[model samples]
Target: MNNTPESSFERCPVCQGSGSLRHLVTIREVPYWRCERCQCTLMDARCRLSPDDEQEVYRLHDNQPEDPGYRRFLNKLAGPLLARLAPGSEGLDFGCGPGPALAMMLREAGMQVRLFDPLFYPNHGALAGQYEFVTCTEVVEHLHHPLETFSLLDRLLKPGGLLGVMTCFQTDDSRFANWHYRRDPTHVVFYREATLQWLADHFGWVLEIPAKDVAIFRKPLSQPPVPGNG
Candidate 1:
Protein backbone atom coordinates (compact mmCIF):
# COMPACT_ATOMS: atom_id res chain seq x y z
CA MET A 1 0.00 0.00 0.00
CA ASN A 2 1.08 3.56 -0.64
CA ASN A 3 2.42 5.49 2.36
CA THR A 4 -0.07 8.36 2.19
CA PRO A 5 -3.10 9.64 4.10
CA GLU A 6 -5.33 8.98 1.08
CA SER A 7 -4.48 5.30 1.40
CA SER A 8 -6.14 5.00 4.81
CA PHE A 9 -9.38 3.53 3.51
CA GLU A 10 -10.82 2.07 6.68
CA ARG A 11 -12.66 4.11 9.29
CA CYS A 12 -11.16 4.27 12.76
CA PRO A 13 -12.49 1.02 14.24
CA VAL A 14 -12.38 2.22 17.85
CA CYS A 15 -14.02 5.67 17.76
CA GLN A 16 -15.69 5.41 14.33
CA GLY A 17 -13.81 8.53 13.32
CA SER A 18 -13.88 9.33 9.63
CA GLY A 19 -11.44 10.99 7.25
CA SER A 20 -8.98 11.48 10.07
CA LEU A 21 -6.44 8.72 9.57
CA ARG A 22 -2.96 9.71 8.45
CA HIS A 23 -0.40 7.23 7.20
CA LEU A 24 1.86 7.05 10.22
CA VAL A 25 4.51 4.65 9.02
CA THR A 26 5.29 1.43 7.18
CA ILE A 27 7.28 -1.62 8.25
CA ARG A 28 8.22 -4.66 6.22
CA GLU A 29 6.19 -3.01 3.40
CA VAL A 30 3.02 -3.09 5.53
CA PRO A 31 1.36 0.28 6.00
CA TYR A 32 -0.18 1.55 9.23
CA TRP A 33 -2.30 4.61 9.90
CA ARG A 34 -3.02 6.65 13.02
CA CYS A 35 -6.45 8.03 13.90
CA GLU A 36 -6.27 11.71 14.69
CA ARG A 37 -9.31 11.51 16.98
CA CYS A 38 -8.42 8.47 19.09
CA GLN A 39 -4.70 7.91 18.46
CA CYS A 40 -5.43 4.24 17.64
CA THR A 41 -3.25 2.77 14.96
CA LEU A 42 -4.41 0.25 12.36
CA MET A 43 -2.68 -1.96 9.87
CA ASP A 44 -3.90 -2.09 6.30
CA ALA A 45 -6.44 -4.93 6.07
CA ARG A 46 -4.54 -6.40 3.17
CA CYS A 47 -1.75 -7.33 5.51
CA ARG A 48 -4.01 -9.32 7.81
CA LEU A 49 -3.54 -13.07 7.74
CA SER A 50 -6.20 -15.54 6.66
CA PRO A 51 -7.97 -17.39 9.48
CA ASP A 52 -6.18 -20.64 8.80
CA ASP A 53 -2.88 -18.85 8.51
CA GLU A 54 -3.55 -16.91 11.65
CA GLN A 55 -4.30 -20.05 13.56
CA GLU A 56 -1.15 -21.60 12.22
CA VAL A 57 0.84 -18.66 13.51
CA TYR A 58 -0.83 -18.88 16.90
CA ARG A 59 -0.03 -22.57 17.05
CA LEU A 60 3.60 -21.59 17.04
CA HIS A 61 3.29 -19.49 20.20
CA ASP A 62 5.22 -20.64 23.27
CA ASN A 63 2.61 -19.49 25.80
CA GLN A 64 2.81 -22.59 27.90
CA PRO A 65 0.78 -22.42 31.08
CA GLU A 66 3.27 -24.71 32.80
CA ASP A 67 6.15 -22.39 32.03
CA PRO A 68 7.20 -20.40 35.09
CA GLY A 69 8.22 -17.46 32.95
CA TYR A 70 4.79 -17.39 31.33
CA ARG A 71 3.08 -17.53 34.71
CA ARG A 72 5.12 -14.58 35.91
CA PHE A 73 4.27 -12.69 32.73
CA LEU A 74 0.57 -13.21 33.39
CA ASN A 75 1.02 -12.03 36.97
CA LYS A 76 1.60 -8.55 35.62
CA LEU A 77 -2.15 -8.22 35.14
CA ALA A 78 -3.47 -10.80 37.57
CA GLY A 79 -1.50 -9.54 40.56
CA PRO A 80 -3.09 -6.11 40.54
CA LEU A 81 -6.56 -7.40 39.68
CA LEU A 82 -6.49 -10.06 42.36
CA ALA A 83 -5.69 -7.46 44.98
CA ARG A 84 -8.95 -5.65 44.20
CA LEU A 85 -11.28 -8.63 44.10
CA ALA A 86 -13.29 -9.88 47.05
CA PRO A 87 -12.59 -13.43 48.22
CA GLY A 88 -13.87 -16.11 45.84
CA SER A 89 -15.00 -13.56 43.25
CA GLU A 90 -15.98 -14.92 39.85
CA GLY A 91 -14.17 -13.67 36.79
CA LEU A 92 -13.90 -14.36 33.11
CA ASP A 93 -10.65 -14.64 31.20
CA PHE A 94 -11.56 -13.34 27.82
CA GLY A 95 -9.38 -14.56 24.99
CA CYS A 96 -7.71 -17.05 27.23
CA GLY A 97 -5.86 -18.44 24.21
CA PRO A 98 -4.68 -22.04 24.09
CA GLY A 99 -3.16 -22.36 27.54
CA PRO A 100 -5.45 -20.15 29.66
CA ALA A 101 -2.53 -19.43 31.95
CA LEU A 102 -4.13 -16.37 33.49
CA ALA A 103 -7.27 -18.32 34.24
CA MET A 104 -5.17 -20.95 35.97
CA MET A 105 -3.44 -18.29 38.05
CA LEU A 106 -6.71 -16.66 39.06
CA ARG A 107 -8.26 -20.01 39.97
CA GLU A 108 -5.22 -20.79 42.07
CA ALA A 109 -5.98 -17.63 44.03
CA GLY A 110 -9.47 -19.00 44.90
CA MET A 111 -11.35 -16.92 42.33
CA GLN A 112 -13.54 -18.86 39.92
CA VAL A 113 -12.40 -18.19 36.37
CA ARG A 114 -14.44 -18.86 33.24
CA LEU A 115 -12.44 -19.11 30.05
CA PHE A 116 -13.47 -17.88 26.60
CA ASP A 117 -11.49 -17.65 23.41
CA PRO A 118 -12.86 -17.26 19.94
CA LEU A 119 -10.16 -19.55 18.65
CA PHE A 120 -9.67 -21.89 21.57
CA TYR A 121 -12.39 -22.14 24.21
CA PRO A 122 -15.40 -20.68 22.34
CA ASN A 123 -17.57 -21.04 25.43
CA HIS A 124 -20.60 -19.05 24.32
CA GLY A 125 -22.27 -19.66 27.69
CA ALA A 126 -19.49 -17.73 29.43
CA LEU A 127 -20.58 -14.69 27.49
CA ALA A 128 -24.02 -14.83 29.14
CA GLY A 129 -22.76 -14.47 32.70
CA GLN A 130 -21.77 -11.42 34.70
CA TYR A 131 -18.43 -11.32 36.44
CA GLU A 132 -16.54 -9.39 39.12
CA PHE A 133 -13.61 -9.03 36.74
CA VAL A 134 -12.71 -9.77 33.12
CA THR A 135 -9.26 -10.00 31.65
CA CYS A 136 -8.08 -9.66 28.05
CA THR A 137 -4.34 -10.06 28.10
CA GLU A 138 -2.49 -9.47 24.83
CA VAL A 139 -5.78 -9.87 23.04
CA VAL A 140 -7.08 -6.38 22.24
CA GLU A 141 -4.50 -5.70 19.58
CA HIS A 142 -5.96 -8.46 17.41
CA LEU A 143 -9.55 -7.27 17.62
CA HIS A 144 -10.96 -6.37 14.23
CA HIS A 145 -13.89 -4.61 15.93
CA PRO A 146 -12.79 -3.41 19.34
CA LEU A 147 -15.86 -1.26 19.81
CA GLU A 148 -18.14 -4.27 19.85
CA THR A 149 -15.76 -6.22 22.09
CA PHE A 150 -15.59 -3.35 24.60
CA SER A 151 -19.35 -3.03 24.55
CA LEU A 152 -19.75 -6.73 25.25
CA LEU A 153 -17.26 -6.50 28.11
CA ASP A 154 -19.13 -3.55 29.60
CA ARG A 155 -22.39 -5.43 29.48
CA LEU A 156 -20.88 -8.63 30.86
CA LEU A 157 -19.51 -7.02 34.02
CA LYS A 158 -21.54 -6.46 37.17
CA PRO A 159 -21.59 -3.02 38.73
CA GLY A 160 -18.14 -1.92 39.93
CA GLY A 161 -16.44 -4.75 38.06
CA LEU A 162 -12.93 -4.48 36.70
CA LEU A 163 -11.78 -4.98 33.13
CA GLY A 164 -8.09 -5.79 32.96
CA VAL A 165 -6.22 -5.45 29.67
CA MET A 166 -2.62 -6.37 28.87
CA THR A 167 -1.06 -5.28 25.61
CA CYS A 168 2.08 -3.47 24.64
CA PHE A 169 1.07 0.13 24.14
CA GLN A 170 2.13 2.19 21.19
CA THR A 171 4.54 4.68 22.67
CA ASP A 172 5.43 6.97 19.78
CA ASP A 173 4.89 7.33 16.06
CA SER A 174 8.60 7.58 15.36
CA ARG A 175 9.27 4.25 17.08
CA PHE A 176 6.32 2.45 15.46
CA ALA A 177 8.10 1.42 12.29
CA ASN A 178 10.60 -0.77 14.07
CA TRP A 179 8.52 -1.81 17.08
CA HIS A 180 8.63 -5.60 17.48
CA TYR A 181 5.01 -5.68 18.62
CA ARG A 182 3.89 -4.22 15.30
CA ARG A 183 5.60 -6.97 13.36
CA ASP A 184 2.94 -9.52 14.23
CA PRO A 185 0.65 -9.90 11.23
CA THR A 186 -2.38 -10.83 13.33
CA HIS A 187 -2.13 -7.63 15.32
CA VAL A 188 -4.37 -5.20 13.47
CA VAL A 189 -5.39 -2.52 15.95
CA PHE A 190 -3.01 -0.77 18.32
CA TYR A 191 -3.82 1.33 21.40
CA ARG A 192 -2.11 4.28 23.03
CA GLU A 193 -2.73 5.80 26.45
CA ALA A 194 -4.96 8.43 24.85
CA THR A 195 -6.91 5.83 22.91
CA LEU A 196 -7.71 3.96 26.11
CA GLN A 197 -8.66 7.24 27.79
CA TRP A 198 -11.16 7.89 24.98
CA LEU A 199 -12.73 4.51 25.72
CA ALA A 200 -12.91 5.26 29.46
CA ASP A 201 -14.58 8.63 28.89
CA HIS A 202 -17.10 7.29 26.39
CA PHE A 203 -18.01 4.20 28.42
CA GLY A 204 -18.30 5.90 31.82
CA TRP A 205 -15.51 3.77 33.27
CA VAL A 206 -12.57 4.79 35.44
CA LEU A 207 -9.20 4.01 33.83
CA GLU A 208 -6.02 2.97 35.56
CA ILE A 209 -2.61 2.21 34.13
CA PRO A 210 -1.05 -0.09 36.68
CA ALA A 211 1.89 -1.02 34.51
CA LYS A 212 3.48 0.09 31.25
CA ASP A 213 1.43 -2.47 29.27
CA VAL A 214 -1.55 -2.85 31.59
CA ALA A 215 -4.88 -0.98 31.63
CA ILE A 216 -7.54 -1.52 34.26
CA PHE A 217 -10.94 0.08 33.73
CA ARG A 218 -13.42 -0.03 36.54
CA LYS A 219 -17.11 -0.04 35.78
CA PRO A 220 -19.15 2.56 37.63
CA LEU A 221 -21.28 1.31 40.52
CA SER A 222 -24.32 2.80 38.82
CA GLN A 223 -24.80 3.61 35.21
CA PRO A 224 -24.28 7.27 34.51
CA PRO A 225 -27.22 9.25 33.17
CA VAL A 226 -27.14 9.87 29.48
CA PRO A 227 -26.79 13.42 28.25
CA GLY A 228 -30.04 15.41 28.82
CA ASN A 229 -31.60 12.46 30.68
CA GLY A 230 -33.06 14.74 33.34
Candidate 2:
Protein backbone atom coordinates (compact mmCIF):
# COMPACT_ATOMS: atom_id res chain seq x y z
CA MET A 1 0.00 0.00 0.00
CA ASN A 2 1.38 3.41 -0.92
CA ASN A 3 1.49 5.60 2.20
CA THR A 4 2.39 8.78 0.40
CA PRO A 5 -0.20 11.55 0.29
CA GLU A 6 -1.58 12.06 -3.17
CA SER A 7 -0.39 15.21 -4.84
CA SER A 8 -2.50 18.06 -3.44
CA PHE A 9 -1.82 20.59 -6.21
CA GLU A 10 -3.07 23.15 -3.73
CA ARG A 11 -1.36 26.47 -3.13
CA CYS A 12 0.30 26.92 0.24
CA PRO A 13 -1.89 29.04 2.48
CA VAL A 14 1.06 30.76 4.11
CA CYS A 15 3.09 31.88 1.11
CA GLN A 16 0.68 31.23 -1.75
CA GLY A 17 3.23 29.02 -3.45
CA SER A 18 1.84 26.31 -5.70
CA GLY A 19 2.91 22.67 -6.12
CA SER A 20 5.14 22.68 -3.06
CA LEU A 21 2.97 20.99 -0.46
CA ARG A 22 3.61 17.42 0.70
CA HIS A 23 1.97 15.40 3.43
CA LEU A 24 3.91 15.90 6.65
CA VAL A 25 2.04 13.70 9.09
CA THR A 26 -1.28 12.54 10.46
CA ILE A 27 -2.13 12.59 14.13
CA ARG A 28 -5.37 11.24 15.53
CA GLU A 29 -6.49 10.82 11.91
CA VAL A 30 -6.09 14.51 11.08
CA PRO A 31 -3.84 15.24 8.11
CA TYR A 32 -1.17 17.94 7.90
CA TRP A 33 1.09 19.13 5.12
CA ARG A 34 4.40 20.96 4.94
CA CYS A 35 5.18 23.56 2.32
CA GLU A 36 8.51 23.23 0.60
CA ARG A 37 8.55 26.90 -0.29
CA CYS A 38 7.88 28.44 3.10
CA GLN A 39 8.47 25.55 5.51
CA CYS A 40 5.02 26.13 6.99
CA THR A 41 2.99 23.16 8.12
CA LEU A 42 -0.77 23.38 7.76
CA MET A 43 -3.58 21.06 8.73
CA ASP A 44 -5.86 19.71 6.06
CA ALA A 45 -8.73 22.08 5.46
CA ARG A 46 -11.26 19.26 5.82
CA CYS A 47 -10.19 18.79 9.43
CA ARG A 48 -10.85 22.36 10.50
CA LEU A 49 -13.44 22.92 13.21
CA SER A 50 -16.45 25.12 12.71
CA PRO A 51 -16.24 28.74 13.87
CA ASP A 52 -18.44 28.12 16.90
CA ASP A 53 -16.38 25.14 17.96
CA GLU A 54 -13.12 27.06 17.50
CA GLN A 55 -14.41 29.97 19.57
CA GLU A 56 -15.47 27.57 22.33
CA VAL A 57 -11.91 26.22 22.54
CA TYR A 58 -10.57 29.76 22.95
CA ARG A 59 -13.14 30.50 25.64
CA LEU A 60 -11.71 27.71 27.75
CA HIS A 61 -8.42 29.57 28.13
CA ASP A 62 -7.78 31.35 31.47
CA ASN A 63 -5.02 33.81 30.63
CA GLN A 64 -5.96 36.58 33.00
CA PRO A 65 -4.09 39.78 33.90
CA GLU A 66 -3.59 38.59 37.47
CA ASP A 67 -2.20 35.19 36.53
CA PRO A 68 1.45 35.49 37.40
CA GLY A 69 2.29 32.34 35.52
CA TYR A 70 0.64 33.60 32.39
CA ARG A 71 2.30 36.96 32.83
CA ARG A 72 5.69 35.28 32.91
CA PHE A 73 4.88 33.28 29.84
CA LEU A 74 3.91 36.45 27.97
CA ASN A 75 6.91 38.32 29.27
CA LYS A 76 9.03 36.25 26.87
CA LEU A 77 7.64 38.33 24.05
CA ALA A 78 6.84 41.48 26.01
CA GLY A 79 10.25 42.02 27.57
CA PRO A 80 12.07 42.16 24.24
CA LEU A 81 9.37 44.23 22.57
CA LEU A 82 9.25 46.76 25.38
CA ALA A 83 12.97 47.27 25.17
CA ARG A 84 12.68 48.35 21.54
CA LEU A 85 9.73 50.71 21.85
CA ALA A 86 10.02 54.36 22.88
CA PRO A 87 8.04 55.85 25.69
CA GLY A 88 4.28 56.00 25.21
CA SER A 89 4.33 54.04 21.96
CA GLU A 90 0.89 53.45 20.48
CA GLY A 91 0.16 49.84 19.57
CA LEU A 92 -2.43 47.16 19.01
CA ASP A 93 -2.79 43.72 20.50
CA PHE A 94 -3.92 41.69 17.55
CA GLY A 95 -5.69 38.46 18.42
CA CYS A 96 -5.55 39.15 22.13
CA GLY A 97 -7.49 36.24 23.62
CA PRO A 98 -10.32 36.35 26.14
CA GLY A 99 -8.34 37.94 29.01
CA PRO A 100 -6.33 40.53 27.03
CA ALA A 101 -3.56 40.22 29.60
CA LEU A 102 -0.87 41.22 27.13
CA ALA A 103 -2.61 44.49 26.43
CA MET A 104 -2.91 45.19 30.14
CA MET A 105 0.76 44.40 30.60
CA LEU A 106 1.79 46.80 27.86
CA ARG A 107 -0.49 49.47 29.21
CA GLU A 108 1.18 49.09 32.59
CA ALA A 109 4.48 49.84 30.86
CA GLY A 110 2.97 53.13 29.69
CA MET A 111 2.17 52.16 26.08
CA GLN A 112 -1.31 52.75 24.70
CA VAL A 113 -2.77 49.56 23.27
CA ARG A 114 -5.96 48.93 21.34
CA LEU A 115 -7.37 45.44 21.30
CA PHE A 116 -8.72 43.38 18.40
CA ASP A 117 -9.73 39.75 18.37
CA PRO A 118 -12.13 38.26 15.87
CA LEU A 119 -13.67 36.14 18.60
CA PHE A 120 -13.34 38.24 21.75
CA TYR A 121 -12.79 41.94 21.09
CA PRO A 122 -13.70 42.29 17.43
CA ASN A 123 -13.66 46.01 16.88
CA HIS A 124 -13.20 46.61 13.15
CA GLY A 125 -12.39 50.23 13.81
CA ALA A 126 -9.31 49.27 15.76
CA LEU A 127 -7.72 47.97 12.56
CA ALA A 128 -8.44 51.13 10.60
CA GLY A 129 -5.36 52.98 11.80
CA GLN A 130 -1.69 51.97 11.85
CA TYR A 131 0.35 51.69 15.03
CA GLU A 132 3.93 51.85 16.25
CA PHE A 133 3.85 48.21 17.31
CA VAL A 134 1.59 45.18 17.05
CA THR A 135 1.77 42.06 19.17
CA CYS A 136 0.29 38.74 18.02
CA THR A 137 0.94 36.10 20.64
CA GLU A 138 -0.11 32.54 19.86
CA VAL A 139 -2.28 33.82 17.05
CA VAL A 140 -0.58 32.92 13.76
CA GLU A 141 -1.30 29.22 14.18
CA HIS A 142 -5.03 29.86 13.98
CA LEU A 143 -4.94 31.87 10.80
CA HIS A 144 -6.94 30.18 8.04
CA HIS A 145 -5.79 32.66 5.41
CA PRO A 146 -2.25 33.54 6.34
CA LEU A 147 -1.45 35.51 3.21
CA GLU A 148 -4.37 37.87 3.63
CA THR A 149 -4.00 37.96 7.39
CA PHE A 150 -0.31 38.78 7.17
CA SER A 151 -0.99 41.46 4.60
CA LEU A 152 -3.43 43.00 7.04
CA LEU A 153 -0.83 42.83 9.77
CA ASP A 154 1.65 44.60 7.53
CA ARG A 155 -0.85 47.39 6.88
CA LEU A 156 -1.49 47.77 10.61
CA LEU A 157 2.04 48.98 11.23
CA LYS A 158 3.52 52.44 10.78
CA PRO A 159 6.85 53.02 9.03
CA GLY A 160 9.73 51.68 11.14
CA GLY A 161 7.18 50.07 13.49
CA LEU A 162 7.54 46.68 15.10
CA LEU A 163 5.43 43.55 14.75
CA GLY A 164 5.91 40.82 17.30
CA VAL A 165 4.67 37.25 16.95
CA MET A 166 4.82 34.28 19.30
CA THR A 167 4.03 30.72 18.33
CA CYS A 168 5.55 27.33 19.09
CA PHE A 169 8.11 27.05 16.30
CA GLN A 170 7.83 23.69 14.59
CA THR A 171 11.05 21.77 15.12
CA ASP A 172 12.25 18.18 15.32
CA ASP A 173 10.02 16.43 12.85
CA SER A 174 10.66 13.20 14.74
CA ARG A 175 8.44 14.48 17.55
CA PHE A 176 5.86 16.31 15.48
CA ALA A 177 3.20 13.70 16.09
CA ASN A 178 3.40 14.21 19.82
CA TRP A 179 4.00 17.95 19.80
CA HIS A 180 1.56 19.61 22.17
CA TYR A 181 1.12 22.69 19.99
CA ARG A 182 -0.02 20.66 16.96
CA ARG A 183 -2.58 18.69 18.97
CA ASP A 184 -4.90 21.64 19.32
CA PRO A 185 -7.65 21.52 16.71
CA THR A 186 -7.70 25.31 16.45
CA HIS A 187 -3.98 25.50 15.64
CA VAL A 188 -4.11 24.74 11.97
CA VAL A 189 -0.83 26.21 10.77
CA PHE A 190 2.72 25.82 12.11
CA TYR A 191 5.76 27.95 11.29
CA ARG A 192 9.44 27.14 11.33
CA GLU A 193 12.24 29.68 11.79
CA ALA A 194 12.78 29.53 8.04
CA THR A 195 9.10 30.23 7.55
CA LEU A 196 9.36 33.42 9.59
CA GLN A 197 12.32 34.50 7.52
CA TRP A 198 10.29 33.98 4.36
CA LEU A 199 7.64 36.36 5.72
CA ALA A 200 10.27 38.97 6.56
CA ASP A 201 11.76 38.81 3.06
CA HIS A 202 8.38 38.84 1.38
CA PHE A 203 7.19 41.88 3.33
CA GLY A 204 10.52 43.73 3.15
CA TRP A 205 10.73 43.81 6.96
CA VAL A 206 13.83 43.24 9.08
CA LEU A 207 13.42 40.09 11.19
CA GLU A 208 14.65 39.44 14.70
CA ILE A 209 14.35 36.36 16.89
CA PRO A 210 14.84 37.91 20.29
CA ALA A 211 13.70 34.74 22.04
CA LYS A 212 12.49 31.25 21.41
CA ASP A 213 9.12 31.00 19.70
CA VAL A 214 9.17 34.77 19.28
CA ALA A 215 9.79 36.77 16.07
CA ILE A 216 9.95 40.53 15.77
CA PHE A 217 9.75 42.28 12.39
CA ARG A 218 10.55 45.90 11.78
CA LYS A 219 9.03 47.64 8.77
CA PRO A 220 11.32 49.97 6.88
CA LEU A 221 10.82 53.67 7.40
CA SER A 222 10.38 54.04 3.64
CA GLN A 223 10.29 51.62 0.78
CA PRO A 224 13.12 51.95 -1.70
CA PRO A 225 12.25 53.09 -5.19
CA VAL A 226 11.83 50.37 -7.77
CA PRO A 227 14.65 49.92 -10.25
CA GLY A 228 14.13 52.10 -13.33
CA ASN A 229 16.03 53.76 -16.13
CA GLY A 230 16.93 57.03 -14.45
Candidate 1 whole-model C-alpha lDDT, 0 to 1? 0.88
TM per prediction: 0.93, 0.95
Give the poorly placed runs of model 2, Cα more than 4 Å off: 7-9, 224-230
lDDT of 2 by residue, 1-230 (tens): 98766644368888888788989887777778989999999888988999999989999988788999999999999999999999999999999988999999999999999999988898999999999999999999999999789889999999999999999999889999888998888999999999999888888889999999999999999955322211
Off by over 4 Å in 1: 1-5, 8-10, 225-230
The superposed Cα distance between candidate 2 and the true structure at residue 89, in angstroms, equals 0.4
TM-score for candidate 1: 0.93
TM-score of 2: 0.95
Q: Clashing residue pairs, candidate 2?
A: none
* Candidate 2, run of 10 with poorest lDDT: 221-230
- Local distance difference test, each candidate: 0.88, 0.91
Give per-residue CA lDDT, model 1, range 1-230, as digits (tens): 74353554557778877787888777777888888988999998777899999999888887988899998888999899998899999999999899999999899899999999988899999999999999999999998888879989998899999999999999887778778898888899999999999888878999999878999999999978422211
